[model samples]
Target: MSKRDYYEVLGVERGAEERTIKKAYKKLAMKYHPDRTQGDKGMEEKFKEAQEAHEILTDSRKRAAYDQYGHAGVDPNRGGGHGQGADFGDIFGDVFGDIFGGGRGRQSRARQGSDLRYNLEMSLEEAVRGKDVEIRVPTLVECDICHGSGAKKGSSPTTCPTCKGNGQVQMRQGFFAVQQTCPTCSGKGKIISDPCTPCRGQGRVEKTKTLSVKVPAGVDTGDRIRLTGEGEAGESGAPAGDLYVQVNIREHEIFARDGNNLYCEVPLGFATAALGGEIEVPTLDGKVKLKISQETQTGKMFRLRGKGVKSVRSGSIGDLMCKVVIETPVNLSTKQREMLEEFDASLGGGKHRPKEQGFFDGVKKFFDDLTK
Candidate 1:
């Protein structure tokens, strides 16, 4: 029986590119693969024909000869038997991997190290001023005995015979090829028959490393500093990963922070609030004097310029806001009580307490309106 034309079998034009030919083959491979055909001989033969066409078209040299001489150029009895030497297993992997999921294309060793995070809590004082801190981290490091080869002293890892250093092996299920990690090498592409004493068969050992970190001023919670190559050691001598120092500022006792601004409540004596005087207010740097105005009431907000934190990003300073709370006098003596009563008698509600007078007047009008 005469063989069918390769392009006709793959359902592609003779002038199709290699990419188009591969796409056509992949579609047919999925539809007519032996495993999917359920023992249908005709579908199995169709899949084989598509495979032969793909193998010939993908190789630049073989494709040129086949295009020039037709089937005679690729006859097995002649010098065209190999037909570009493309591996059918690779073609199957490409088709099935896309149909199922990706990442099955190729495999390799020398995996990168895993990234690490360390949460460090600092006081508000320390976070504001900034300081250098030393931290100890327990992580995996390269084994000293075998130099990350996972072998005994004077010995090294050898290529995995099962996969020939490919780190992967193809499992065929009725011509449906699937790639999996080599069981013998565990995907490392190497085997260590003689295990290391310190790290056993693994390439890394657990050790505590001390590192110094400079905490910048104005760093708040959720801010992080990355230390390159300070994390867990990579497998088989790959570069180490990064260590992230996450900052968390603790709550302050006297002041609360909102962005770069600082807020604090200041207590004022009743006499001071009414008569006015100079009072000492606490700040991050030191105490500063704030002058109180005459007849100052509670809940008055006072602004202190440049008394708040400096922004790390913008380098701009914020203002300090003080909310005043008037404290009432306590534990009065008999003389003071007599003086207070006399003072209270001398004050008129309308003149001395205008706010209180207005409140009572509104209450009386509300009751009068209700009655009407």
Candidate 2:
């Protein structure tokens, strides 16, 4: 029987690009793979046909010949045909590597070191003004004794006999050829006959390293600063990872921060709040005198512009918000109590306390309406 047109087998257009052809083949291969089909003869044949079609269509020279002369130009059984058996290893490597962890020879894979995170605590003033901090981190570093070779000073690593330096071994499972990391070499592709004393045959050693990190101004909690190449050391001379310094601002006794804004509660004496006066308020910089308006109520907010923090990224300054709480006189002496009684008798008509009068009036009206 004559073979089906490669494009027809893969369900692609005659002029489809290589990528389109590969995509179609991947779909069909996944659907009809022997493992999924469970030994169905028809599905097995269809899978083979898709693989063969993909193999020919992806090769530029083979595709051009097939496009000009159809199957007759590329059929392996035909005289002067250019087609050869499809390489299962290459096919599965492209499609199933991520799924099965099998693919291209991983011989001498250079793994990148793992990134590390360090929590750095800072005071509000330190975060606002910025400071240089020293941190000690326990991480992996390249072995100096063997120079990261994992071998003794006088000896060197040799190729593994099991994988023959390929770093991978091939296993045949039914119709599929799988490539896996070599068990003996553990994917390093080499063996250390004489191990290093310091690192114990590993190319990296654990050590504590002290580094100086420059903290930028106006950095809030949860902000991060990156220090490159300060993390764990990579294996087999690979590139080292990075260290991220995570900022954690400690709570201040007098102030709370939200983004760039600073909030604080200011206590005012009842006499000062009612009579109006200038009071000293604390700020990150220094003490600032704030004017308290006459008859100022509790919970009144006073805003001090540009007294908060400037954003590190935007460079825009914020304001400090102070909420005042009126404090009443406590532990009155006999004279103070007598003066307070006389003061109460002097204001018997509730003329100075408009809020208190309005509240009592509302309460009386509610009771009168209920009685009616």
Candidate 3:
């Protein structure tokens, strides 16, 4: 019987791209696979048809000939086809390589080591100005005795006998082939006859290493500094991983930071707040004098430009905001209390304190309305 068109078998357009053809074939293969269909003859035929269509369309030469002259151009009987033999394993590998972790030929067993994280706590002053700190980390380092070979001196590792150094062993499972790591070599591809004493058979040793890290200026909490190749040593002489230093800013006693800005509460004497005087405010750099205006109320904010932290990423300096808190006089002497009473009596009720007067007036109005 005449065969169906390749594009029709895969349910793809005549001018479909290679990726589109592959996707269609994958869908059909998954639907008509013998394992899924349970030995149904009809589904088996459909699977073979889809597989054949994928083989021809994926090959540039065969696809070109098929495109120009249809199946007649690729038929082995017509003496115009490429080699008719196609490995079903290769086709499955191409479609499901990532899923099963098989295919892509042989891969090296030597893999990079795992990355590590270290939490570094810094004072606010140190974070703003930047500082170099020495930190000790306990991690896996390459064994000095065997030079990461896992073997004794004057002897080396040999290829795994069972897997022939392929690192993986293929297993046949009822029309499907799967690959798993070799049990004997543990996927290292090589076996050490004589193990190193320091690290045993592992090729790496657990030890403490001290490294100096330079903290960049204006780095806040949660910032990370990467030290390349400073993490755990890789297996079998592979490349080492990285060490990430995570910054955690310690809480400051007087200052609170938000983004690049700094906020601080400044307690001012009632006389200084009312009579308008200069007060010394603290900053990261040094104490700066801030002028308080006359009749300054509590909770008033004063901004000092460029006195805050500079952003590490943007390099933009921020302002420092000081919130004034009026402190009332406490523990007055008998004479002071008498003088304050006289002073309060001398001022007409509400002339000296407008805010206090306004609040009382509102309260009076609210009570009058309630009575009415």
Best candidate, lDDT: 3
lDDT of 1 by residue, 27-137 (tens): 999999999999999999999999998999898887876654445345544321223322221221121112112213433577555555566878888888888999976
For candidate 2, write residues 346-371 as lDDT tens digits. 98886889999999999999999999
Runs of candidate 3 with Cα error greater than 4 angstroms are 1-108
Q: Compute each candidate's TM-score over C-alphas.
A: 0.68, 0.68, 0.69
Which residue pairs overlap in candidate 1's backbone? none
- Residues 126-184, model 3: lDDT tens digits: 99999999998766788898998888888999999999998899999999999999998
Model 3 lDDT, residue 301, Cα: 98
The C-alpha RMSD in Å for every predicted model, in order, reads 22.9, 21.3, 21.4
Cα-based lDDT for every prediction: 0.76, 0.78, 0.80
Residue 294, candidate 3: Cα error in Å is: 0.3
| Residue 8 lDDT in candidate 3 | 91
Error of 3 at 42 (Å): 41
